[model samples]
Target chain A: MTLFIQQLFDGLALGGVYCLAAIGLTLIFGVLRIPNLAHGTLYMLGAYVTYFFLVTVGVPYVAAIGLAAVVLAVIGVLLERIVFHPLRNAPHTHHMIAAVGAMFFFQAVAQAIWGADFRRMESPISGSVTILGAQISWQRIVIVVTAVIVLGLLTWFIKRSIHGQTIEAIEQDRTGSSLVGISPSRVSMLTFGLAAALATVAAGLVAPINLLAPTMGDALSLKVFAIIILGGLGSLPGAIVGGFTLALAEVMTSTYVSAAAGEGIAFVVIVLVLAIRPTGLFARAVQR
Target chain B: MLTVRGLSAGYDAVDVLHAVDITARAGELTVVLGANGSGKTTMFRTISGIVRPSAGSIDFDGRQLPDLSADSIVKAGLAHCPEGRHLFAKMPVEKNLMLGGYVRRRNRGRVRELLEHVYELFPILHDKRHQPAGTLSGGQQQMAAIGRSLMSDPSLLILDEPSMGLAPLVTAQVLDAVAQINRDGIGVLLAEQNAQTALRIGHHGFVLAEGRVVLSGTASELLDHPDVREAYLGV
Candidate 1:
């Protein structure tokens, strides 16, 4: 029983990172209407940024995460303005192609700067707390707590803030929003910046627990795609719930079934969900 | 006041509006009557800065509107209640209305007043404020769309087919609300396929056919014009 509880606890901590990453990707997809293939690249860069701040500049762990978020936000805005904005009117395929191009370009950049070698950052958080005979690492606990706070703030902002409401408006109707004085371009920029910040923060939180490499984000990007698809594309709550669900599934499969099956679970989920309910688990016909 | 001179605009290569000339005086309801694909929507979109004119200029309350962005145009006091009542269907009706007041959001008290004004104008919307806009009856949705545009406190409100999908009684109710709105001293530019009903309440009217203005006059004169009656009124 304790062993099962330990596995469940581990899944919850890992799920926080997935949830944050999925929310960012979902937000960009919902508002900007871009699939954003390069989303995972932003996560990879975020881990490196966190590493630079923590090891080179010697900033505190939390401060490193904050600085990484700011840096990623700027990069995100630049990416939107320079790459996506020009092709806003092009066909959907054009956007996807551009995103894939961006992903490759960023991966090359990361390889050039950080090299292809894998590096692991030391966690400032050490020690473990025991609960019900299960040991939980302090780093994982910090990650879980940070995810909760950030998710809470994000939900509140989207639900309550005027700016967030504008984002929602744009997501619902682009031309309608513009007629009412919401600049779609401005909102797109803000969404990209926010998405980037979310991705980076998620990456930074997990950096202490995982090895970092230029290729690290490739698998992560695919997993996020699966998550968003499972949750329902452009559905915010879908993405949130989908993220945790995917993480827990993987954790359970790895523990009870085979490790290889756990690694392949995302692809299976994508196929099964698409074949059965392509609109996803949350999407429904518009009310009325 | 709004003025459009030699305005030409369209999608891609196909021009939907051709050198359309129009002038809507401040505080008066100006109606543009047209059949489907007659370019009423394109004209309004050009004025609202959604579709850029291929030629000519637009002047709104003395501001050069051609070069301004869509949001800037709204800030300049022209709110477009687009055809089809494109409210954020999933959001509550009040949220949809509040978004119209987004530019004036900094002035909390003023926004509140605008909200109150819209509620007063469409009490049904106030009662259904918490409901998702898509769930409203067709007439109520139209009311919500008009109320949303009014929230911007636009000096001139451009309404495109508020009666598009409503029942005859509901259409009359919505149009009555529009007339009441115009009496409140805001300028109105309305486009409608229901020509006679629109001209009855309008100060000035223009008839559009195949992307060109075929006729223009005071509402009473247009009502009596043989060409208008023969073509649009089906008399």
Candidate 2:
């Protein structure tokens, strides 16, 4: 039972990272209606930014994470204004191609800047605590706490704040939102920037535990896509629930079964879920 | 307070409106009556800056509004309540209404005041203020849509098919609310397929057929026209 509890906490720590990435992806899909394929590249870039800030700039760990978030947010806003805004009314195919192109471009850029090698950051929190007779890394604790706080704040913002409600309105009906004076374009830019910042934060949090490489984000991106599919696309709460569930399942499977089979677990669960609720766990009945 | 001259717009490869001329003055309820595909909604879209005009110009409140964005247009005091009650489905009714005042700078207090006013106009919405807009009845959604538009505190309020998909009694309530809104000093530009009800409340009426205004007159005059009776009023 203690082992089970320990495994659950470990699963939750990993889930926190996935939740941040998935939330970003879901938010971008919700407001922009564009599946941002480059989102993972942004995540990798964030890790690299943190690395540079810590190693070269000699910034403190917390400040490095903060700087990475702000930097990525600026990059996101720039991408929105330069790339996404012009393609607002373009065909879905065009956006898909553009996003894929952006992903490749960012990958190339990261490889050029950071090189094609795997780099891992030193953990800011190197200590551990005893929880239920299990050793728990302080970093893991930080991850879980940060995820809950960020997600909780995000939920409150979306549910209670004015700008967040406007974004929600735009997501539901773009044309209708425009009629009510909510600028879809402006909202799109904000959502994209926000998604990018979230990816950065996720990368900063997980870089200590995970190796960072230019291509590392590709697998993470796929996992996020799976999470989005499992959670309804455009549902923020769904992303959180889906991320944690997928993470726990993967961890349990890897522990009980072969490690090789653990990777396919998320897909198996996704397929089963899709068979039952094709619209995903949190899909609203009304189609956009 | 609104004028359109030689305005033309269409979705890719299909022209909807061709050189349409429309005008709405202050303190008047101007109704645009048409059949489906007659470009009534298209006209509203053009005026509200959703559908950009292919040619000519739209002058709202004495300013040429060709390249302005939709929110900017709304900020300029023109509010559009679109055809469908596109209330944010997952959001609460109060939040949806607050979004309508997104561009208003100093009218937050006024927004609260208007909320009470709107609640009085459609008492049903007040009861459902905390509920998700998607949970509201069709008529209630319609009222929320209109109330949302009014939240912007626009001098010119444009509504597209405000009476669509409702029982006659519900339609009467909506139209009555619209008339009440107009009586409170805002100019209204209403597009509707229900000609008899629209014409009954309008100060001036324009009949649109295949994009252009086929006829225009005082509401009573248009109501009495033999061609209007045959084609639109069904009397």
Candidate 3:
């Protein structure tokens, strides 16, 4: 029973990371209607930015994470203004191609600057807590707490705030939003910035445990995509459910089944959920 | 007041509206009547700044609006209630209404006042204020759309097909609300395929056929015209 509880706690910690990544993907998809293929690249960029601030600039680890998030948000706004804005009304294929191009461009830039080295980020928090007779790292607790706080704040904003309501309006119908005086372009920029900032937070929290490299986010990106698909394309609650579900399933599979199979569990879950629901587990039946 | 002269618009190569001229006066309901594919909605789209006019000019409240964005046009006091009652489905009815005042950030109190006024106009919206807009009936959604437009406190309110896909009783209810809206001192530009009902409440009416205004006159005059009766009024 203790073993099961330990694994569950571990799963929750990992799920926090997936939730952060999935939130970025889902937010961009919800407001922009474009599946941002470059999202993983932004995640990788966040980790590198944190690394530069902490190791090179000699900033405190926590402050580095905060700065990285702000930097990534600025970068996201720039990308929105320069690349995404002009292509707003363009075909889906065009935007998809641009996202792919951005992904490659950012990855290449990271490789050129960081030299493709697998670097570990030092944990800002040290020590462990005994939870249900299991020793859990403080860093892991921080990750889970951060995810809960960010996701909670996001939920409140979308549910209650005026700008958040405008975002929802734009998501439902862009032209309708415009008719009501919500500028789609400005909302798109804000959504993109928020997505990038979330990605940065995800990276900052998990980089200490996972090695940082240009390709570090590749698997994480695939896992986030799977989570979003399982959750529902644009449903925020679905992303939360899907993220934790995938994390728990992976942990359980690694503990009981083969460790090798644990890596493949997310994809399997995504396929199974899609086969059963098609529109995703939480997706509404109404076609947009 | 709104004025459009020699307006031409199209998607890529095919022109939808060609050199269209229109004028809407203050405190009057002006209905643009046409069948489907006659560029009725397209006209609203152009006026609302959704579609860029290839040539000519749009003058709203003595300001040229050819270069303004849709949001800017709404901020300039012209609000459009688009066809199909495009309320934000997943959002609550009240939130959808709140979005109507997104451009007028300085007048939040006025926005709330407008919300109360719209709720007074359509009591059903107030009852379902917290409900998701998608779950509402078609008539309710139409009311929410109009209510949202009213939230902006627009000087000129434009609506497209306010009677589409509605029962006669529901249509009458929607038209009555629209009539009340016009009576409140706001200019109204309405487009509809339901020519008879639209003209009944409209102060001035224009009959559109094949992307051009075939006739324009007082609502009573157009209602009595033999050609309009035969072609549109189903007399």
Candidate 4:
């Protein structure tokens, strides 16, 4: 029972990270209709930016995270304008190809700037506590709490705020949005920026628990795609629930079965979800 | 307030709208009558800057409209209520209306006033204001769509096939709302397939066929014209 409780906390911590990752990618897909194959690369770059600010520049941890998010946001905007915007009218394949190209190009830039060595960051909150015979790291607790707050705020913004409804408006009907004075281009830029910022914040929170590498986001990207697919694509609540579901599934599998099966859970999820409910668990009925 | 001369536009290489000349004056409801595929939608798309005119010009209140973006055109006070009644289905009715007022969002008080005015015009929308726009009945959806356009406080409102896909009574209700909106001092450029009804409410009318303006006259004249009577009114 104690081990199970410990694993649950572990799963929740990882779930928080997974939710952040899925939210960023799904939002861009939901609004821009671009799958953003390079999203993981953005995640990796975010961790590196956070590391540079906190360690190299000696900035305070919170300020470092904020700066990193801002930097990633600007990078995201540039990527949208230079790559995605040009391919907006192009075939879907072209957007994927461009994203893959961007991934490779940005990865090379990171390798040159930071080197390919595996690195890790030290968190400000460095301690552990025991509750109900389960030990939990403060950092992990922070991750879970912060993720909940951020997502809650995001939900409010999208649902209640005027600027955020523009995103929802464009997602529902592009032509209608234009007719009513919502600028798709401007919204696209803002979506990309916001998604990137979310990614940075997630990476900053989780990097202390894991090693940082240029390839860190690659596997996570696949996991995030699985999450969004499991949750209805572009559905916010779907992503959140799917994130925790996948994380818990993997954690339980790894503890009870082989670790290899844990790593393969994403593939299992993709296959099962595709076969059973292709539109995902929360997908609205297809519009006529 | 809005003028188009020799405007041509199309998807890819095929032109959908040929050098179409149109004029919609301030304080008048100008109706464009056409059959399916007669380029009424394409013309509206061009006027609203959704499609770039390959030739000629679109001038609105002395400003060249074709040079602006679609959203900019809305900001310039020309609102388009598109043919399909494309309400953001997943969003609430009030959110849809608020998004329409996004351009003038800085004036929170006026937006609230606009919301109240729209509610007064279509009380059903206010009753269903918290409901998803997609869930509304057809007539109520049309009312919401029109209310959304009005939220932008447009000087010239262009409605495309506002009566499409509704029961006769609902169509009359929606058209009646359009007439009410026009009477409130907003210039209206209406496109419709229902000629007799449109002409009855319009100050003047233009008949379009095969991407060209086939006829133009006062509403009563077009209502009496043999060509319009035969082609559109099915008299």
Q: Which candidate achieves the best TM-score against the true structure?
A: 4
* Top model number, DockQ: 4
Model 3, position B38: C-alpha lDDT score: 86
**What digit string (tens of lDDT, one per residue) describes model 2 on residues A139-246?**
999999988988888888777778777777877888878887777777887887788888888899899998889998998998898898899988887899999999
| TM-score, per-candidate, Cα-based | 0.97, 0.96, 0.96, 0.98
| Ten contiguous residues minimizing lDDT sum, candidate 1 chain A | A279-288
A37-71: candidate 3 lDDT, tens digit per residue: 88999999999999999989989987898899999
Please, what are the lDDT tens digits per residue for candidate 1 over residues B61-165?
888898899998888889999998789999999999999898899999999999999999999998999999999999999999999999998999999999998
Q: Pick the winner on DockQ between candidates 1 and 3.
A: 1
lDDT of 2 at B180: 90
lDDT of 4 by residue, B74-169 (tens): 999999999888899988999899998988899999999999999999999888999999999888888999999999999999999999989999
Please identify which of the two predictions, 1 or 4, would achieve the higher DockQ against the true structure: 4
- State each model's C-alpha RMSD to the native: 1.8, 1.8, 1.7, 1.3
DockQ, candidate 2, comes to 0.80
Fnat of each prediction? 0.90, 0.88, 0.92, 0.94
lDDT on C-alpha atoms for all candidate structures: 0.91, 0.87, 0.88, 0.91
Superposed Cα RMSD, model 1: 1.8
After the best TM-score superposition of candidate 3, give how far the Cα of residue A158 lies from its true spot, in angstroms.
Answer: 1.6
| Colliding residue pairs in candidate 3 | none
* DockQ value of candidate 1: 0.87
